[model samples]
Target: MERTGRMETITYDCIREAAARLKGAAHRTPVMTSRTLNKQSGREIYLKCEQFQRGGAFKFRGAYNTISRMTEEEKQRGVLAYSSGNHAQGVALAARLSGVPAVICIPTDAPPVKLAATRETYGAEVLTFDRLTTDREAFGRQVAEERGLTIVPPFDHPHIIAGAGTVALELLEEVPDLDAVITPIGGGGLLSGTSIAAHGWNPKIRVFGAEPKLAADTYRSLQEGKRVSIDPPSTVADGLRATTPGVLTFPILQSHVENVVLVTEEEIEDAIRFALLRLKTVIEPSAAVALAAVRKGALPRDCRKVGVILSGGNIDPSLLAQLWEREATKI
Candidate 1:
């Protein structure tokens, strides 16, 4: 693990201000209750359904807040970003809403459904590169320089962290006495945001981060007492493929997050299937990490009130069919 001086740490006040800035721009996604989850887990569960958010993920809140806070000059130059799917859609839609042109750098291996949605629905320019050979961050920087586009990072930016904190803000508003809160971590945006909001609301509430075992950089980082990178991450959770934790999110997580738990790919798939079958909601693999943690006994058994952030719902129909068939065969 190594420390990078380039990263900016986000603060509780910063997140609060960012939430205020995103007041009308981002959706205050609902806190859904499930009797099935309660019975199965033996604890009251409050699911923060970010799947209902605009662009079908909590990434929208950060994107909109970050883009909206840009200078007029920055907006005039347009915006550029790199993402596998959710963040790409978030940045594209946010740019569109702000009347700014957007260019999204995507890996050639990105899901076809997500790529299509980003281009057709948001009208963003899609630039594809080989996932194995190309460095997306470098590509994004090159595009930004060439096109005069301001880079609105997916999770590393201060404004992005702040915007993401709003999810916890809304969640605690509905479930004030939550014993513990769990959220999936990618580049640490959502987890950091959740930490800020939960601790800010009530310091007694514990916040935990759930990560896929194959791409568990955050979990390793916390253990090593510094940031770590997991190159060529192998996992079904495409959205949590970030190799390095964000500079802005790491400090907040270190200060506020109580633990980081790892979930296997199989566990993630099972959680996704459980959400679809029992909750009747579509959740991406990354979003299901929190639920996977619970199902695997990563959370404390005595936690009376638990909150899990169900971060997104977008899934290719083919993948959905495959998952359903797999579940059926197992049954």
Candidate 2:
């Protein structure tokens, strides 16, 4: 696919069209405020708690919106997708809801909790690949061809981008005067979509994206002024492990996003702990990227009213306990 260049020109009409398509399918996830967070950060924090979203992540919003628009023939043919975690659950649940059979291609090394959830909960067929040697996109395409399944890409589709945009729609509705908004980026679906919605509502609203430094594809892409691929992503944040940003999303991000900040594994761990201890939320490492950005001063301190999208809360309990133990040892 050819890269989209300078996406700031993306009009509100496109976003409105996406909003209309996503109506009733996507949840209007709530904007939650924490007085404790407010006191500590010294900023009024509005958390777009997408942890409460269907399939436990905001990915479902885009998945459903995209699949729901598919033709009846397409539905009968079913859908195929590749994801390590959140997007797997999103595609699975979306296909289930749309009454279509779904196949998810996942890394063999994917977290047991996420893989099990994708298969058992959503009733999707799971195909595992050796992360060390297998090419997921190629494998996914093969599966789609063999099974006559329409590929619902994790990001890159216009409908998917629009669907993802609804998160910011709901957030802006609840907190109209947000000084800035921060979200985690993988393939740039959520970041691009949210940036479009945020800028549509208020052009001055600062839009930032956070990434794990271990797998900072989007950050590198932004710096290079083009999409870049990370051949071997090594990050605890499974949801942010996409090798490259989508062509469509990259252009949108290049124009609208204020910055793409990278956070180290340690900072990510600290942010996860902060979410668990202070916010009382079990956020996945991917979701912790935004909070980590805030703690690292990646976001502007002058922004009094800030909105952070807690992308998901599907951490494995065993891993959670282990993370807590590690934190305890450091103290």
Candidate 3:
């Protein structure tokens, strides 16, 4: 299958190169399987556990892959990026590993644990913005220009997409016969990468994107055949609250993804609880979006073997109180 008019720079070759670059830097996070997951979904479910990834999320792959390739002068100048939380931690950690400085802009209301981890744990200079009022991309660019810092976009860059593709690349290498793959979409980095890797490995494999229904920008974009910006989401999945898809990623997702699954906040919370209680693992709400889709039968019935990426586990352990206030489920 010839992929014409697709992202030119992000091929299987590029993804393979990223895998090579990430060999030692990124953890080869395990492919997890559970009888309970299989029974709930009625399919052979392979869970790509990225919660165990460096920086406690898969964003480190792209952050390191992008920042590590910078010129010596650029590394000395350092990098700038904006995120709600996970990408900031990834960039801060990667910069530390590379012996460079990183400036991260995060939302003021971002999870306290994530904010602390980005600032104190990873040792990045942190800036806060009102996510509801400020445009983060514009703010990041302004700061980068003033400080002469290199910009590391959360997504929309070829290297980021290729780096993210490595997750699916590793998964397919371990489980080549999967009938479908699902990943949560936030500006489409992970989903686009997963689509490229999954289709590249086996063109027959189905690819799906999962999103919280409250933050249904990607869903609306796919329907209207262009990017759509919604009001800021009040969804529990804070990490997935992008109002629109990336300019580059939207096209890749439009081209390759089978469909986008929109799940409710309740379903997402249920998945979080399910993972903790039954699966004996921790997953944040954003990661739980993918699981909610699978466990709730949102995929096609023909998908007998499904692969799901549990994207992160950066939720504050205390957040369990807010999520399960009435119930007595303790982490």
In TM-score terms, which candidate is top? 3
lDDT of 2 by residue, 1-331 (tens): 1224643344555667766776777677777777877887788888898888889999898898889888999999999999888889999999998899999999987888889999999999999998779888899999999889999998888777887888888888888999999999988989988998999899999999999998989989889987888886888888888888997889889899989889998899888898888878788999999988877766677988999999998887787899999988988
lDDT of 3 by residue, 1-331 (tens): 1345764547888889899999999999999998998987889999999999999899999999999899999999999999999999999999999999999999999999999999999999999999999999999999999999999999888888888999999999999999999999999999989999998899999999999999999999999999999999999999899999998899899999989999999999999988987888898899999999999999999999999999999997677767767347453
Candidate 2, lDDT over the whole model: 0.86
The TM-score-based order of candidates, best leading, equals: 3, 1, 2
TM-score of 1: 0.95
List ranges where model 2 is wrong by over 4 Å: 1-11, 17-23
Q: Once model 1 is optimally superposed onto the true structure by TM-score, how far is the C-alpha of residue 25 displaced, in angstroms?
A: 2.2
Clashes of each: 0, 0, 0
Q: Is candidate 2 or candidate 3 better by TM-score?
A: 3
Estimated TM-score for each candidate:
0.95, 0.93, 0.96
Q: How big is the positional error of residue 268 in model 2, measured in Å on the Cα after superposition?
A: 1.0
Best by lDDT: 3
RMSD of each: 2.7, 2.6, 2.3
